[model samples]
Target: MMNLDAVEQAGEQIWQTRKKMNYTTLGLTVAYTVQMLRDGEIYIPEYQGHIVWSDKKRMRLIESVLLGLPISEFFAVKIDEEKWELLDGVQRLTTLDAFLNNDIQLKNLERLSKCNGFRFSDFSALEQGKFESRGTRVVLLLENLRLETRLDLFMGINGLDKQATL
Candidate 1:
């Protein structure tokens, strides 16, 4: 049988943690976010590891954005008044960076097959403008949040689920 006292204590702890979470939701343009990444204002936590997204995966992300699909919200925690750390969405952010900066050649795309073999620079001005102006939703965790709480949130939200795609 389960220990009732232990269960009660765990429930109380969960309540306390939930009470302490403070966050805000905002939409930022793709160009703004990519610039933030380039300017080093947004940092990817070491726990996220390196970029593991393949070209096909990256291409699909770009295609989804071009198609105006609803992409997942990015989760980040404010490290200080001027800095922020990415807690989740590393793959998506890095993929955007790689594609927007023309670091990778996209191919084998199904929906946007016409974009095959094209880098960011090769896109028409209208297509590039559309991509740059796209809105991306983000969840910002305030700096008051404890590191342990941030990790717990990350694991609970992302570690248990398979990767999300549109």
Candidate 2:
């Protein structure tokens, strides 16, 4: 059992450590996000999970976008002025990228049934534009942070212990 004073001291220490971490939140448009991915601006860490979302799940995500539902914010760590390491939301980001790049065809979209068989190209120009302009929220842990801390945070955020080497 922990002493009351010791517990309070530990809590204060945790709060102070968290205060030292820097981060920011912003809304990035789909077009900008796709461009970043295409241009290789964001880095996916090796320990990140592989894309395993089923076609139905992917379709539902797209359907949510089309229906204006809020998506969970992506978490990344800034590597420098021009690069970032993605920590979370890889599945969502990649799925959106694949869909916009015409690599994914919508199927089993319950809410957007008419778009079930459609690809990005099949959408009307206005609809396509709207989709491209959609904003996804992202949380970025700023640069200058230690790699170990970043990895620890990633593990904490994802609840994984893959023994990442870097």
Candidate 3:
């Protein structure tokens, strides 16, 4: 069986390319989200789909893109309708999306020796100062995988905190 949890090899290059893309993925996702917003797509806030992300986690994800961090933690799944479903790390994705769209400005870091940030928008070079100076990384997985048992998987992915017995 494949170590679905083991970080994939392409993780590094994808992360590098993403940084080279200078928040390109984030930009695209943001634009898509914006269209959703304009289309009046509403996500229930009570779902806490509105969970607030902190500066530290945002920095880690930004750094994950900039530094070629491995794709160790989560699985990326392409849902039937083609939505990019993060099997885990919803909070992380939300944070990255928010920062990229300027719903929040990423905080603290210095310029990347590799790419010029200004040619872009929210990640304009000005924001590069906030990128994690080191230990940044992320890798994209190409596997079209769904858990053998989605209920167990969803509970596993979301955690057991909500399950309780009276």
Candidate 4:
């Protein structure tokens, strides 16, 4: 079991490592769109690919934005200085990805294009404003845990709801 200090140290180290990686899909164009769904990456044909965000979810996000709510959430992940991978909260991260790519249309927002495994990013100017205002957050946890740990974080945040991960 990890003590408080040890856990804190582990987390800090992970962040340091993550920063070192300096990950940003910013300019990287997506050669293919992969859906990080409940099963895994599923390539979607241009015509078939669609944002999974339902009306309710998109509406809630829009309302939160209109209300000036902050929606950044960190996903805790285990770390290995040599080889790092997601240890938890991959679903929310995946969802944010969908939003970033402009997959799900916000109340007034529209769908953009898709990127990577599952990122939608190609949108009408009007839609962009709506979702951008919603403001989603990504939280990454640093700890050397395994799939079990990742599952725990996913369930913890999802609350018994089986969420998708990209």
Off by over 4 Å in 2: 49-51, 162-166
TM-scores of the candidates are 0.84, 0.90, 0.40, 0.38
RMSD of candidate 1 to the truth, in angstroms, is 4.6
To one decimal, what is the Cα RMSD in angstroms of model 3 from the true structure?
12.4
Clashing residue pairs in all predictions, respectively, total 0, 0, 10, 23
Q: Clash pairs of candidate 1? A: none
> How many clashing pairs in candidate 2?
0
lDDT of 3 by residue, 8-105 (tens): 64676678754532111221233344333344331222223434567666665565665545423433443334443444455654654455555654
| TM-score preference between candidates 1 and 3, better one | 1
Summing lDDT over every window of 10 consecutive residues in candidate 1, give the lowest-scoring window: 157-166
Cα lDDT over the full model 1: 0.81
Q: Candidates' lDDT values, in order?
A: 0.81, 0.84, 0.43, 0.42
Look at candidate 3 and tell me the lDDT of residue 51. 48
Task: Quote the lDDT for 65 in model 1.
Answer: 90
For candidate 4, what is the lDDT? 0.42
lDDT of 4 by residue, 12-83 (tens): 999995564323221111111112332233212222122354555655543453345665443434255433
Q: Model 2 reaches what TM-score against the true structure?
A: 0.90
